[model samples]
Target: MRSSVPGTAKKFPLHPGHPERICWGCDKYCPASDMACGNGSSRTQHPAEIFGDDWFEPDPGADDAGAGREG
Candidate 1:
């Protein structure tokens, strides 16, 4: 039987990571491995904690990113 819920698959995408979004399933920082939804989901304070927005990509060393003077 078809589900009444709209976008049923969207509610819980099978892969759990194709959209490159923070996995709501594992709640951990990952590149969309094989995350599965369960009672083991964890929570972090910052977005970087999950994706590490700073550590992974260090300063690009450019005028825009490494600009010392304010213009």
Candidate 2:
């Protein structure tokens, strides 16, 4: 199970190939186009949404596409 200190938060990127704009931030997988748990706010988005596609690049050897953060 995923564990973290309370009050702390983490962000996950949207899966690149999802047909619908789905949120990868948590296990919920809420769709960006029709967010059910967003409470009017768009579900957590990837840096690429605010920045550009190049905002985060995939690591050459890493298996997961959104494995790292730029800090």
Candidate 3:
């Protein structure tokens, strides 16, 4: 059998396993299956998300690589 409290919101369990990750940019709660900005902080959120690889270090080589690959 199941149990419930009077007038309380229905409480349901998530999946078997999951992680609660919040999006620093949107301030929305994201699940494990979702993606979270690696460099989330008070300084910037979108910057880290838009530029994942270069978030740590602004590599000049990245720009040159893109320029060379362009048609």
Candidate 4:
């Protein structure tokens, strides 16, 4: 089951066209330069930035083809 944590349960886009403009640290989705949460850190990088464009895609070498499928 997915966690009920604040940011953890929020919906996030898989491939935002512009990931650099917003901070992903919190649900506020603050502007990169203006982090409202003040976590004492720079903007959190979107998954795409750290893992390339296919970050959410299933690994081709994985054996579990139905791992993330709903049905």
Candidate 1 lDDT tens digits, 16-48: 323454444433343344445442444222335
Cα deviation at 67, candidate 2, in Å, is 28
**Each prediction's number of clashing residue pairs:** 0, 0, 0, 0
Estimated TM-score for each candidate: 0.19, 0.35, 0.21, 0.69
Candidate with the larger lDDT of 2 and 3: 2
Where does candidate 2 have its weakest 10-residue lDDT segment? 11-20
Give the least accurate 10-residue stretch of model 4, judged by summed lDDT: 1-10
Clashing pairs in 1: none
Model 4, span 1-71: residue lDDT tens? 24577547567888998999989887677889889999568999899999999999988878686678897
Model 3: CA > 4 A from native: 1-23, 27-56
TM-score of 3: 0.21
**In TM-score terms, which candidate is top?**
4
After superposition, the stretches of candidate 1 with alpha carbons farther than 4 Å from their true spots are 1-36, 39-41, 44-47, 50-52, 58-71
Candidate 3 backbone collisions, by pair: none
Task: Flag the better candidate by TM-score, 1 or 3.
Answer: 3
Ranking by TM-score: 4, 2, 3, 1
User: How would the candidate models be sorted by lDDT, starting from the highest?
Assistant: 4, 2, 1, 3
